[model samples]
Target: MSRIVSLTASVFAIGLFAGSAVAAGDTITIGIPVGLSGANSVVAPSVVQASELAVDEINAKGGILGKKVVLEVADDASGAAGAQKAYDLLIFKKKVDAIVAMETSAARNAGLPIVNRGKIPYIYTSFYEGRSCNPYMYINAWVPEQQVAPIVDYFNKQGAKTFFLIGSDYAFGRGMLAFTKEYIEKNGGKVVGDEYAPMDATDWTAVLAKVKAVNPDAIITSTAGGAPNVTLTKQLRAAGIKALYGNLAVDEGTARSMGADAEGIYIAGSYFTNIDTPANKSFLAAVEKKFGNDLKTPNELSVPQYEAILAYKAAVEKAGTTEAAKVVPALAEVSVEGPRGTIAMSKQRHAPLTMYLGQVKADGSVSIISSFKDVDPGEQCPKLK
Candidate 1:
């Protein structure tokens, strides 16, 4: 944590992101508040890379609304307490016009009220537990409807009648699995055991013991995104639990980093490197060229960060101003086609996402198994209008 803090201070001091917005003196500042330490640390680099690529591209072609754009980044350290500090530094101190972030659900929840008070356009770029609504906020990531259904439905088809559930015991972990449990029960599947550990719990021996005893046909986990995902998956493999494994929260980059431990496990997502679309190809090339060896693998968690920044730009263009009230509504009215396909958020304050069911290979690559297009985020703040 200290080393990360030092690195952040050095970047800011060196004027790394001080762009033409400085010389122009007329700029729209967009703050990126993401986790640089703790559970989200493993996935935050991908978000940072995607954000840098999108911002550089946007700035290259004139800036947003004829004003140069500047990005101010602060690390939330992956929890509620850290989020408050990150939000305060960006919102009150820097006075950014907008925020584009892919943060943990706890961090998002903690920072949202501050963003509202500051009255900036906030674009949340994480696939989360859902149902978070604010007048000035919009989300471009998957919810339970888009992400969980494919996994449950596919497992059911594979004759996975009995299952066990495990999670990080947080809002995202419990919330997603709650929906999974309901979905399983509704689909006539049975759950033998359901367990949750703390968000930061690294040791899963006891959890595996409980999981192993059930002997269910399948096991699904929803740990906190980065470190917990790695820890639990590694331990699950080491313990040789062997029931069919599925993850609701692991991103492609983390999955790949797990090596053999992640092989044969299943996940549902919105984007992958092998998307084979012109937009995705172009985006990937730009990121690779810009960051080169430092680039983290782009995945569902980070792709939406890039898209959200673009979508925010579109909303500002559509609204003809950066005022939160106007841009907020315009956000739902606009669309951005990026690596994940075209994303058109709804008046309900959520997007209709395209979902993919993928299985991780021995080398950490995910192979697509099935796809569902334009899945609606059901009833997420329907009264937002």
Candidate 2:
């Protein structure tokens, strides 16, 4: 962790020095408060790398308003309190121009006090249970309506009306199930069972045994690496729970880690490895070139971190200033040509997002089963008005 912070510090210091030495007139610091340690670190490195890549690409293209972009990353260590402290340090000490965050909605929610008080632009880069409308915060990933709503419709179409809800017992999980439950009931489906596991629990046999006993026609889970999606699948399969298993948690990296055990699982997200777009192809090739075959792009879950940086760059350029008031409006109008597609932010909602549903192939690869033909930010946050 220290090595990572040192590397980030060094790179950012270089950017700062380069800003002064080169024609670049200023330096804009973007703070990242994310799970940089613990189990969630599997995705943190990629998030940092993606943000760095965006900064590099922008700097190479003359940067934002002749100012070099610098990243200030602090370890959240997968805890809400730790994430809040990281955000405070980055804001009070580093004095960053904007903030980008990862998973752990609790962390983001906790940091809202600082962000609202400071009134600096903030972008969240995780597919989450969204309903926040902070003028200063632009959520740059899929929300419940975009990620989970369609899955309910899909399952209903398949005649899988009964469901069992499972997830980590946290803001992200609880919020997701809240929306999922509403959708299931609205769609005429019944939820036969529900369960919650701690964010870092390793044993889920008890939960799986209960799920098997309930034996719903389908199961939906919202979880992350701490309580990996595979652990549930493994225990469920062993428990002889043959119901259709689906999750919003199984991204390409998770699927790869789960190996054959992940096959036949259904997943709903905002991005997929099999997206046939020039943007995605080029992005994947670049990631492969940089990280080698061992690392996967982690689906659209990882794309928001990359896109948020680019969006920040574009906002700075469009606003012609780094002031939050100027940048916030510019951000709502900025459309990023992300790997998934063009992601446009809506002024009504402080979020820019899209949606994609895919099924894990027998080989652990994903096949896009359905997609919103055009990326939409969904219903804008009414409160933003």
Candidate 3:
């Protein structure tokens, strides 16, 4: 698959930056570092498409602060080494003004120091483990408090007393399960089993057998990224485990891809494609019009890519310049009404977003059953100001 997609006709090639002397005022460049291969490849295309949609829309409205926005994309290839290489190329080689990145914690951790040294604004657009804070970096996705606590509360109300935990063997998976266990125990529930598999592992026979042996009231899975998530869910259904299933990592696109196997699985996130609000409907229509039927359904993982670009544009317009020192503080003050409703960047450098709890219907779409408004990330970072 091609790592770069140029939305505008006048996009400059990544190699052009090596010799070309360009003025930043002519066009603002936003670099996108995404996993175009490996474990995360299943969802990377949607992230890129969503970002292009946002760029097109912003350009249609005369671009950001009178300058057209262009995307310079680099493939992360779904690993730390790949992420480092991509970030280095985007920051030093391409000289992009800002970046929107979607990858695992390992990749993000590897790339953050480079971004910090460059002092370019980076918007991380994935739901991740909490307490990640760095200068010039902003997070647009839900953290543990914004996503886990509400879902656990809802599950507790549904008579789920004992829970089983499963995840990929990594920081994101382990960290999320740790938070889930904390919330479950704090809410008067007990953990019956906890298990983890490698991110690329496809075999889940033993894990499903353990779930059957434990006989927990509900099962929470945090399998990393796309393929592993589908494998785990499908295997669980095949084994006919009767425990209520709550998926912390499955997005709407992944759920739809699962077809009938995704039915009845519960999930919580900041956005679902089926949300009926005017803002959400507009976003869906724009996406459908832009990408037509070729694109997969937008999900929590992909939609935030669109929102992050819009937020960056807002911050740039408010600051009246693309300089990181000015835009970083401006980002904390700007809010954009996106598919997920009005999202404001917090003083802590993460969005204070709404949380939606839903279950997958037989048709592989989400039906929103409950929502928590204005959920804060609850972790404080160094103030950008």
Candidate 4:
């Protein structure tokens, strides 16, 4: 919105921009360290837009605590190295009061120490491997517990006895599949193929060949969100291997981008563009009015970003200050009704999400098969609260 304000090349050979109704230093700064490049680039625009809408709405309503909100966005590049660079500039240089990010787990890990060192509250808006603990951080997104069971259980019920697992060679990929494998077996299904590929690798020929070798009843993939999902799905379709397809990381936007390749790939998520609730309907209207044709479909990854921004505002109002020490504690105690529902991150630094099991239709829209309400995040950082 406002052209994303170009980032200076010196910031990582890229310029940085800030959008605030109030003057620079006079507003509440929310640093969004997201994947503007690399694999997550495809979905980053939606997250940024979500943040913009929340900030704009808050400002329109007289701003937060009488100060407008500003966003300082940096490209994490969807990895540790880029995240380290992004975090350094946003925290140490920009001196942002808080961070609300929807980035890969690797990026989150790379940036958390910097966020903590900067003494700022961090709202990790990514659905991830789970159990990532930090005194200054609260997760307003789904974990493996809320995500895994839906797809796996549906396949099991449909008589899928054997499953194949594949993912990117990273913490998120490995961790998600690991949890999925455990859950599959626990539910009386067998994992036939388990493998991984490098996140940046586009060629899945070898991986596909391996997958073909097993010819399992179900093939589940957990790749890096944006590009990997595109490449792997396309390759899977090209390979002509017919098996029950499921993807743990494909969002509504990414799936749509994949076009026909994403068809029939089952997935589970916390938000869909069609969730019928007054709050979600209003949010959708606002998003449409703001973006129109340019709107990147808001899905699970982005919906939380919008809601988390509101939650952050509530935390600040409750804490009486923007200081991380005070605000961090209030983060989990506040609730925001948005794209999903009443989302409160009170369950051990994580939120209990209402999950949906769906399959990608020919139009790239997900058809909800079953819905699980208030699914527990399950044992994530019990020692925190």
In order of appearance, the predictions have TM-scores of: 0.95, 0.89, 0.92, 0.95
Number of backbone clashes in candidate 4: 8
Candidates ranked, most accurate by lDDT first? 4, 1, 3, 2
Model 3, backbone clash pairs (residues 3+ apart or across chains), number: 0
Query: Candidate 1 residues 303-375, lDDT tens each?
Result: 9999999999999999999888789889888999898889888748898877889999998889999888888
Global lDDT of each candidate: 0.86, 0.74, 0.84, 0.87
* Candidate 3 local lDDT, residue 373: 88
lDDT of 2 by residue, 1-385 (tens): 0012112444334433433443433777888887767546656666766776777788788778877787777888777788778878888877888997776776777888888877899888887777766778888777777778667888888889799999888888888898899889988999988889887766888788777787799999887643367677777766767787778766666676566778888887777767788998888777665545334454555778888888888888889899999998888788889786787676464454456778888776788887765445566587674
- Tens digits of lDDT, candidate 4, 1-385: 1122222233322113444334765788888999989989888888888988898899899878888787888889999999999999999988888889999999999998897788789999888888899998999988999999888888887789999998999999999999999999988999988989988879999988998988899999999889999999999999998999989998998888888998999999999887888888899889878866667788889999999999999999999888777898999779998889999999999999899999899988888888999999999998887
| Stretch of 10 with least lDDT, candidate 2 | 1-10
RMSD of each: 3.1, 3.9, 3.8, 3.3
Q: How close is candidate 1 to the true structure, as a TM-score?
A: 0.95
Question: For candidate 3, lDDT tens digit of each residue in 141-215?
Answer: 988888887678878888999999999998899999999999899889999999999888999999899999989
TM-score of 3: 0.92
- Candidate 1: which pairs clash? none
The candidate with the higher TM-score, 2 or 3, is: 3
User: What's each prediction's clash count?
Assistant: 0, 0, 0, 8
Query: In terms of TM-score, which candidate is stronger, 2 or 4?
Result: 4
lDDT at 225, model 4: 89
